[model samples]
Target: MSALPRPAHGPGSRYTARAATTRPRPARDGDVAALARRLTGRDLWLARMLHEHRVLTTHQIARLAYTSARSAQRRLRTLHEHAVLDSFRPLTASGSAPEHYTLGPVGAALLAAHAGLDPTALGWRPTTTGRIAYSPSLGHDLGVNELLTHLAARTHTASGSGLALWLSERSAARRWGDIIRPDAYAHWRDGDPLLPFFLEYDTGSQPPARVEAKLTGYAAFIAATGSRPALLLHTRTASRDQTLRRRLAAAARELDLQVATSSADFTTTDPWGPWWAPLEPTAHRTTLTGLAAHWPHLSPAAGLEPTDADTPLTLPVPPLPPDLGSGS
Candidate 1:
């Protein structure tokens, strides 16, 4: 008999290998039901987050959920072992990539059962982890999550400032795809002022004009909904940020939109710091909280209420997981 071809493994493989620590097990309905009994509220919250955001690295997950990296890693590995979360580490030219997590079959089943739906209704296929591992927009997705994770992590601090609402691209699309498609939608709370904004994490892959054209959609959204949330354009480079500011200035003014621009160079550590520059001719940058004061006319985006068409499973995932102190 002819020899069978060996399956590819490791870096650059078409089918990226799952973490070696992951023990493959069949996740039948009964098996998943048994696994569900062992899952914590945080675990279930993590599953919902993965389902919404598509993927998250270990660092991001730790920042969002755990007080320590070791704890997050240990718990995440346990989740992977029971097939409650799937993970794959990508090949990197430098050091190894952190394990990226997605919703596992068991996790999906748990969520579906909680929502009183069939497992197939969750839209998670067996190839989900592999697809996210090799996705071209992986970096872009990670960058978006990193910014929001930082915002959410603020809740762990003694400071009373943190993200109040965060809607992933999928959730945002479901809510407002008819008018505009923001990369993410967020309501940030720092003290009494709440800064509601639509985030556009630009990677500079598209032309400046192309980026500016998105403003037209926002204009329509505002006109249709009567909500004037600030538009935050986050670019990969200062140069691209400058390009977008200049390119979109006239259109933004003409549409009477509240817009702010920031670059990755300026927002590495503290995104809520004085990194945002309004579209107007101002050299002074302002904090995210300050933006609310700068543009007092801006209103919170509407349509966040659960609609008649929405199932419990389809609701927006909470920005932060349930409090551990509450026995979650």
Candidate 2:
């Protein structure tokens, strides 16, 4: 007997021309049970998270949801078959890379339906979602998401702090694309002051001139937005961080912009430790909670400061449950 046909649109599916370029139709099953059979509340939540964050990896999703890797893999495969999520594997040097996933057209439609909003208004275009998995910057996009996910997980594990809000690159682009588009924007609540900052993740592949030019654009962004979010540069190596600092100084001299540099070379013990050094004169390595003191130009975190019960940088609230995934 012939084997049953596998799902036809995920990482393992055959790439037909129609599948490659078309938008997914909304699932039309009228029976609620049939619909529920297709997806769970947790599945819908995952879809919303993907919509908000733009992209994530299988490992990241497993962490976000309560399931084991095997379960996440099975669920994601089924969802992809129904076009609820689209995924792709980036070009890697050695073994296969973890599959990266983005919101698919059908998932977006479902979310839009629940909210009583048009999918377009919700930033869900069939063509757009269908095409995102194939983007050349998929790896960079995934890396940025990983950064936020890590912070969210870290906040739970740490003593007294957590993420207040996170804006994905697309959200940043919507507001600041005219001047500069940050990789990510986050509101970090520590003890004394709430901190709002723009994240720039550099792989050390872009030319120094190109990276430095962002400072000029950022100067314009600050003037345009009337918001002074500290610029944090995370580079691949210590040398790259040093070179980037020099470039930032030159750019600062030409245009008024403040930035912080950090090398992503730390061991796991303190992966998010005080590796950040402001571009200002007499800058020193400082933790994320300490950046506010170094970069005075940053605006007072708008209405997100922790209460008297919780001290900044110290744990006030109990750690989050492992399954809910930080809920940031």
**Once superposed on the true structure, which residue ranges of model 1 sit more than 4 Å away at CA?**
1-15, 20-29, 325-328
Model 2 over residues 122-164: C-alpha lDDT tens digits?
A: 6666555435554456556776776667665565466456566
- Alpha carbon lDDT of each predicted model: 0.84, 0.65
For every candidate, C-alpha RMSD to the true structure in Å: 3.6, 8.3
The window of 10 residues in a row where model 2 has the poorest summed lDDT is 311-320
Clashing pairs in 2: 159-315, 160-314, 160-315, 190-312, 191-312
Candidate 1, residues 222-273, lDDT tens digits: the string is: 9999988999999989999888888999999999888999989987657888
- Pairs that collide, model 1: none
Error of 2 at 125 (Å): 5.7
Please give the distance, in angstroms, between residue 216's alpha carbon in candidate 1 and its true position after superposition: 0.6
